[model samples]
Target: MRAITISEPGGPEALVWTEVPDPEPGPGEVIVEVRASGVNRADLLQRQGHYPPPPGAPAYPGLECSGVIRAIGPEVTGWQVGQEVCALLAGGGYAERVAVPAGQLLPVPAGVDLVEAAALPEVACTVWSNVVALGRLAKGETLLLHGGGSGIGTFAIQLGVALGATVVVTARAAKHDRLRELGAAHTIDYREQDFVEEVRRVTDGRGADLILDIVGAAYLPRNVAALATGGRLVVIGLQGGRKGELDLGALLAKRASVAATSLRSRPLAEKAEIVRGVREQVWPLVESGAIRPIVDRLVRMADAEDAHRLVETSDHLGKVLLVR
Candidate 1:
């Protein structure tokens, strides 16, 4: 087998594809022959040595993948060998083969291409868990999603609309039209517009009922300020720096709450539950065409460096995948 490895994390040039021992299934796990993998910002952080794989995970830099099952390990049932599936992985999606927990696997939804299915798991689970589960986003409310052109952002837009919530997003001007077509009711150019004002304005000064933010610190104050009374703010990524000042007075006055979550290092049981929720709730939306995989481009696995470069520049409208 061959996989991408980093000896000394530095840049996109650091991702080296080389021959390695093939993975074997562990208890309750399966070995997958990789078809394609989703490129995420976490992969970039891992390549730069800022993030490391969890214990017992492969030392590669992918968070999700679509592949066919080659073998199933002990204690796993219901899933059979040779099944086409996509998986939510903690690491190792950048390889020719990977060991995945059975609970993390999802069947390829009807009406989706196998390669494009690679884009579904992570974003689906993230949005379902944060927006639906934690934030409890209800119909007729507003959902303000940051990074409208991103994989997670694009998926959230469709899901929010499908659930009857109005969606607003922050992206560069170039992506606004496409995001709007994805069901975003309004788009704000985060670089040029004050998203706090835009979000408030679009919701008719009521503010967003739920805010899903990827930019952590830089937007914290504004996120709180833009929230409606009793609104919930979920921060799933720290693309902006890690440290920032918080306004307790504003948050208190609005009775808003903030939560920060990371999926990669969570316990297996928790991940399995999130995956289950996604399969039960979100998969139907996808299969019904209410939501679709948004693939910006597909680069070969051997050319992961190029994929990383594209993502680093924020040039993609959705997921950039690495295909076998």
Candidate 2:
């Protein structure tokens, strides 16, 4: 087997593709022969030694992948060897083979290619869990999403639209047209405009019913200010640093709430529940052509460093894949 290992984490160059021992499935797990893996900001964080894999997870850095099952472990059932599936992982997607918990596997949606399926699991589960399950974004509500051109953001935009919510996003000006095509009702250039004001203006001063933010402390005050009465703000990443003062008075006045979450460190049962929800609710939208994979480009598995570079630069529109 071959996997990308960090040769002392620092930069993309630290991700070294090298031969490694083959992974064997443990109880309730399955071995997947990876066909492709999606590049994420987390991968870059891991490479820079800022984020480490969870306890007992593979040292390699990847959060999602698409592959065929090679073997199933004890206590696992309903999935078989040779079945094509995409999986959400805590780590180790940047390898030719990975051992995955059975609960994390999702059948490839109808009409999606196996390689492209690699792009779905992480984004799907994240959006489904936060935007739908936690934020409770409903029809006629407005969602303001930061990093709209990102993998999770792109998926969130489409899913919000599919669920009948009005979607607004913040991204570079050049990406706005494509985002609008993906069902974003409005796009704000985060570089040049005040997203809080733009979101307010777009919603007739009502503010967003839900704001899905990746930027952390840097946007906290503005995010709270941009929320509608009784709105929810779900923060999934801390790209903008970690600490910030909260305005309890503002939150109390609007009856708004804020939650910060990460999928990688969650317990297995919770991840299974989220994956199940995604399969039942989100997969249908994908199969029906209401949502599709947003891949910026594909790189060979051996050149994962290049993929990481692309993701770090934020030059790509959606996911950057490392293919076998």
Candidate 3:
């Protein structure tokens, strides 16, 4: 099997393509012949040594992949060799072969290409866990997503719409038109406008019912300001520095809740649970043509560095995939 490795983490140039031993399925796992892998911001963070794979996970970086099952390990059933599936990974998605827990495998949705399926798992799980499961987004509620041009943001917009929320997003002006066509009821250009004011004006001073934040500390105060009374603010990333002061008084006055979580460090059981929820609630949406993965570019596996560079530059409106 061929895999990309980082001998010393730094930049996209650090990714090295080399022949590696083929991975074999372990008990309750399946060996997948990967066709495509989605490059995530976390992969970039891992490439720079800011984030390491969780304990007992593969050292190589890849968070999600789409492929065919080549073999199943003991105790795994109900799936066959050659089944088209995509999986969420703790690591090792940048390889030709990856061993995934059977519980993590999701069948490629109808009308979706097998390779494009690679883009679904991570974004689906992230949106479902935060926007749907944890935030309890309800019909007629407002869901605000930061980084509206991102893979996760695109998914969040579509899923929030399909699930009956009035979706609002913050991105650059260049991306707002596309986001609007994708079902964003409101769009704010974070660089040119204050999102807090824009959101308040658009919502008639009521504020958004839920906010999915990826900017981390830099947006904390604004996020607090954008939330309606009793709203939920879920922080999923800290692209800005992690340290920030919070207005506990404001939170108490509004009876709001603030929470943060990352998918990678979660225990296997919890991750499996998220996967299951996405498979049940969200996968069917893809199958029914209500939603699908948004792929902006595909590069050869050997040129994963280029894909990483695209993601790092924030030039992608959707996922950048590496195909083997």
Off by over 4 Å in 2: none
Model 3, residue 291: distance off in Å is: 0.6
Per-model CA lDDT versus the true structure: 0.95, 0.95, 0.92
Those runs of model 3 whose alpha carbons end farther than 4 Å from true positions after fitting are none
List, residue by residue over 1-324, the lDDT tens digit for candidate 3: 889999797989999999888898889999999999999999999999999998878888999999999999999988999999999999999999999988888999889999999999999999999998899999999999999999999999999999899999999888889899899998988888899998899889999999999989998988999999999999999998798989999999889999998998898889999999998899888989889788998999899899988888787898999998
Candidate 1: clashing pairs of residues: none
Candidate 1: segments with Cα more than 4 A from true spot: none
lDDT of 2 by residue, 1-324 (tens): 899999997978898989999999999999999999999999999999999999999999999999999999999999999999999999999999999999999999999999999999999999999999999999999999999999999999999999999999999999999999999999999999999889889898999999999999999999999999999999999999899888999999999999999999999999999999999999999999999999999999899888887888888998999999
Compared with the true structure, the alpha-carbon lDDT of candidate 3 equals 0.92
lDDT of 1 by residue, 165-281 (tens): 999999999999999999998999988999988887787788989999999999999999899999999999998889989999999999999999999999999999999999999
Q: After superposition, how far is residue 122 of candidate 1 from its true place, in Å?
A: 0.8
- Against the hidden reference, what TM-scores do the models get? 0.99, 0.99, 0.99
Clashes of 3: 0
Q: Which of 1 and 2 is the better model by lDDT?
A: 2
